[model samples]
Target: MRRRLERHLPRALERLAHCIDQVRMWQPGQFNYLNSSQYCLYLYFLSNTIWREERGDEAVGAATRLFLLNKALNGIDLFYEIEMPEVFFIGHSVGIVLAKATYGNYLVLYQNCTVGKNHGVAPVLGDGVILYPNSAIIGRCRIGDNTTVSQGTGVINRDTPGDCMVFAGTAGALVLKPATHSLVADFFRV
Candidate 1:
């Protein structure tokens, strides 16, 4: 596992530092990263430290223990093809999987959330995006920066503009609301 991680050693370390800085925990060689959320961030770095996408399956299997420790991450299988910038936080890991080759930055995913693909089409998320619990993004959608996918909403084959929040209506349709003045405004300080 360490050998595979060495492929992107610098980026992995940088992500780890970012996670430590954000989570505010400084314990080298120790599993004391505050909460399961913090550990999930660490596991993401490990998941992305592969040379090839197809090879990720083996790497993630090796990383299963870390995910199990967190318990929320029901086995984090981050496809190597999916590239992401530094992730800030993960509320819980239950049923969370970046199922295909995707891209994003500063991501926040809660429990039971999936940023997956439909018919081999993976979505591309922008910076500071949050996928709340029970929300699943599918197909070739583009989620703009600072967008929050509200709980229980499923997005498929759509383009969500930047700085917006998506909510589900009674008919299970999405409602795009402006991001300003919403809970996403002050979601994080780090």
Candidate 2:
């Protein structure tokens, strides 16, 4: 198990590096690092350290843990911290905050999205949930499986049903629709 985990470590590291590079390139003057590659390396180390601490043998699992921890400790607006099995986060960027919460597998968060806390309220996200850019889901809500929160949407004090599409605007009311694809496919489709 350990050897199998080690085999995938390099690929995990490469993904982290790529994420960091994209961030640096997107905001050249804003994000600063002593060395450009150090940020990714630090995340890579954190993932390994977290895995060893948790007694888990998989690097990808460890990386997810590290990512959640970093988001929590850094005062990111996330609300809950529940356990998950085999998670994947793509397109993480600066100002993206995840609440201390439990999310199911295949969660994708775009830039500037806030999965925030409202007092004791924390959201429970289901499998294959996609949060688009600038979307905000706050308070104690249950986001159903295969749900997509459109860009700039704010969902507060609501429970979304499974296989639904939700859209929010600055002034208009939030909208929910049926999803075209299955929840499992939303997670696996690149």
The best candidate by TM-score is 1
Candidate 1: tens digits of C-alpha lDDT, residues 50-157: 433335556656545433543444455554345666545666676777765455656777878888888988888877888899998889898888889988899888
Tens-place lDDT digits, model 2, residues 1-190: 4554466556545544443433323332232344423342344344644454444545446557656665554423332223432444445455677666667766767778888779978898897888888898899889998788988888887889979889874476778899877644533433
**CA lDDT of every candidate:** 0.67, 0.61
Minimum summed lDDT over a 10-residue window in model 2 is located at: 76-85
- Per-model TM-score, in order, reads 0.73, 0.60
**After superposition, candidate 2 runs with Cα above 4 Å error:** 1-85, 169-172, 183-190
